[model samples]
Target: MYNPNELLTRFRKYLQAEQLAKSTVEQYCCMTKYFLNYHKCGADRISTSQIISYLVTISSPVSRKQARAAIAKLYFMLGNHQKMNKVPAHVGFYAG
Candidate 1:
């Protein structure tokens, strides 16, 4: 079974390696954790639909955008998802 904490630890390391600011890393990780919790699944199993659903639940536009960016960063760290600006058409709705 995939462990979210282990994956998130790797994500934190990846953020450090990329030289992201400490606060930025924290925010991103927090949003990613929320995402993981919402889906009740491992990071590797997170889907585009799940991401959209999570974003939709955020009432604040600013928070919604931030969460979207954070999820994108997490996906980038995992090495499966692509750049944020170039997210697929299906994901554009939640990109904000």
Candidate 2:
């Protein structure tokens, strides 16, 4: 049961722990915020399927690559899925 705030806080920590650039962390957080909002702010109750579906929807509404990268990070956080396998290579995940 990972609360959204807790999730985000940990995301922030992960960014720092992973040594991601500060700007990258900010961008990832912003992307995640939009994602969280799109999912109705489900907190710790959001499911993987819902997250994947949401990623598909937002991919068109927003930057498809960014959407994919965000989802990949989420998968990493959730620890239940493969990053590259779940995210398409064309999503610009490897761009940055």
Candidate 3:
């Protein structure tokens, strides 16, 4: 699992490395931070239930899609070294 700071740092590197647009990077960064704080858990200790809750907070499918894309971005980071994807367990399972 990624800690909040690590997530931010990695996203920063991804933004620069991938040459993502600033606004796009900012949105992903914000989503990453929101997930970190939403769980009330440490960056390293965030749990599946908390992740589900955060996904549930999305009001629309389009919004959820964007959120999932953000997660996939982090997943790429998590998976760089043959690591597992970082997307939470509730991905594609959240009903709302």
Every model's TM-score: 0.61, 0.59, 0.57
Among all candidates shown, the one with the greatest TM-score = 1
- The lDDT per prediction is 0.60, 0.60, 0.58
Which residue window of length 10 is worst by lDDT in model 1?
87-96
TM-score of 2: 0.59
Residues 1-96 of candidate 3: C-alpha lDDT, one tens digit per residue: 445676687777886688888877877777766765665444444543445447547522326556766666766665533333343443222111
**lDDT string, candidate 1, 6-82, tens digits:** 76787788888889899878877766666656555334344565575576575233365667767677767656466
**For residues 1-96, could you state the per-residue lDDT of candidate 2 as single tens digits?**
445676778788987888888977877776776666655443434544555556656444545566567667776776656534432222222111
| True-structure lDDT of candidate 3 | 0.58
The TM-score of candidate 3 is 0.57
Q: Which model, 1 or 3, shows the larger TM-score?
A: 1
* Residue 12 accuracy (lDDT) in model 1: 84
Give the lowest summed-lDDT range of ten residues in model 3.
87-96
Worst 10 residues of 2 by lDDT: 87-96
Off by over 4 Å in 1: 41-62, 82-96
The residue pairs that clash in candidate 2, if any, are 65-91
Off by over 4 Å in 3: 42-62, 80-96
